[model samples]
Target: MVGLEMNELKKIGLGLTGFGVFFLFFGVIFFFDKGLLAVGNILFVSGVMTTIGVQSSLQFFTKRGNFKGTVSFGIGFFLVIIGWPVIGMAAEAYGFIILCSGFWSTISVFMQKIPVIGWLFQRFGLNQP
Candidate 1:
C-alpha cells in the first residue's frame, strides 16, 4: 500500500513537472508573458519539491556547490514575479542548467528510451550515451 501510494505520488509529481516545463516553453513562445512565466516557475519549484520531498529539495538548493544556482534561480523567480520575464528567464535558465547538470546523464538515459524522440536525440548527437 505504501509503495503504491509512493508510485502514485511520483506520477503526480512528474505530471506537475511536465506541465511546468510546458508552461515555461509556452511562456517563452508567448514573448515571456509574465503570468505564464510566474506560473511556470511556481509549478516547477513545487513539482521538484513534491518529487524530491521538501527536506531533500532544501538540501539540494542549499548545498555549497548549488549556492550560486540557488541564488540566481530565486532571484530569477522574484524578477519574473515582479514583471521582468525576459531577464528573469535568462537567469533561471542558467541556474537551472547549473543545478541540473548532475542529472544530465540520468535524463539522457531516460530520453534514450522515448522511441521517436530517442531516435531524434541519437541522430542529433544529443544522446550522451
Candidate 2:
C-alpha cells in the first residue's frame, strides 16, 4: 500500500512538474517575442507556485486539511483566467479549471436549480446529497 501510494505521488509530481515547466518555457518564449510581460510573468509564477502547491499538497496539508491547497489552486486558476489571451494556452487551460471550480463552489448556494448547472455541480461532487 505504501509503495503504491508513493508511486502515485511520484506520478502526480512528475505530471505537475512537467505542466509547470511547459508554462515556464512558454512564458519565456513569449517574453522574447515581445508579448505582454505582465501576462507572461503571471503565468510563469502561477505555474511554479501551483506546481509547488500540488507537489507539497499532501505533506503540507496532511494535518491542516486541503483548504490551503484549494485556495492556492483557486488563485492560480484566477491568474490563469486573467492572463489568458495575453498569456496563451497555459493560462486558458488553468483558467478553465478555475472556472469549473468556481461554478461548483457557488452553484450549491443557489436556491433555484438551473437546468444543467445543478447536474454539473453534482457530477463534479461539489453538491452533496
Candidate 3:
C-alpha cells in the first residue's frame, strides 16, 4: 500500500538518523585506539546501514499481512546488539541506544497529541491514526 511505503520511508529515515548518531557515538577514538574495537566499528556501521536499508526496502516490497518488516527489524536490532560486543564497545553503544530510542519514541508519541500540529498532518492528507 502507498501508506505502508510512506511509513516505511519514515522509519528508514529514522533508522538512518539513528545510525548517524551511532557514528557520532563511537567515531571519536584517538589514533592510538586499536584491536577488536576497530574491528567492531566495521560491523557496527554495516549493521546500522543494513537495518535502514531493509526497512526502506520492506516498505517498497512488503504486503499488508507479511511479517518481513518485523523480521527485518528484529534482525537489524540483533545485528546492532551483537556487533558491539564483537567490537569491544558494547556497554557504551547499548546504553546510548536505550537512552536515545526510549527518549525519542516517548517524545514523538507525546507530540502526536497536540492539536494544530497533529491536525496539520491530517491537512497534508495522511492518516494519523
Candidate 4:
C-alpha cells in the first residue's frame, strides 16, 4: 500500500514537472512573460520537492557542491517574481544546468530509450554514454 502510494505521488509529481516545463517553454516563446515564468518556477520547485520528498530535496539542494547553484536558482526565482523574466531565466538556466549536471548521464540514458528521438540521438551520436 505504501509503495503504491509512493508510485502515485511520483506520477503526480511528474505531471507537475511536465506542466512546469510547458509553462516555462511558453513563457520563453511569449518573450519571457513574467507571470508565466514565475508560475513555472514555482511549479518546477514544488514538483521536484514532491518527486524527491522534502528531506531528500533539501539535502540535494543544500549540498556543499550545490550551494552555488542553489543560491543562483533561488535568486533567479526571486527575480522572476519581481518581473525580471529575461535576466531571471538566464540565471535560472545557468543554475539549472549546473544543478542537473550530475543527472545528465541518467537523462541521456532515458532519452535514448525514446522512439524517433532516440534514433536521431543515436544517429547524431549525442548519447555519449
- Candidate with best TM-score: 4
Better candidate number, 1 or 3, judged by lDDT: 1
Give one clash count per candidate, in the order shown.
0, 0, 1, 0
Per-model CA lDDT versus the true structure? 0.88, 0.50, 0.48, 0.89
**By lDDT, who's the top model here?**
4
How high is each candidate's TM-score?
Answer: 0.82, 0.28, 0.24, 0.87
C-alpha lDDT of candidate 2 relative to the true structure: 0.50
Model 1: lDDT equals 0.88
Model 2: residue 8 alpha-carbon error in angstroms: 5.2
Q: What tens digits encode model 4's per-residue C-alpha lDDT throughout 1-129? A: 554466878988888888999999999999999989989888888898888788999999999998888888888999999999988988888898889889999998988899998999999999876
The TM-score of candidate 3 is 0.24
Q: What digit string (tens of lDDT, one per residue) describes model 2 on residues 1-129?
A: 543344544655556556555655665576523234334445544444454555454554342444444455445445545554334444444544543453654556682377787677667876664
Instruction: Kindly report the root-mean-square deviation of model 4 from the true structure over all alpha carbons.
Output: 2.3
lDDT tens string, model 3, 1-129? Answer: 644454554666556556555554454453213333343444554444465566654553354533443444444345444543333344445444543452665665566577876576457754433
Candidate 1 per-residue lDDT over residues 14-39, each given as its tens digit: 78888999999999999999999899
- Give the winner by TM-score: 1 or 2: 1
Ranked by TM-score from best down, the candidates are 4, 1, 2, 3
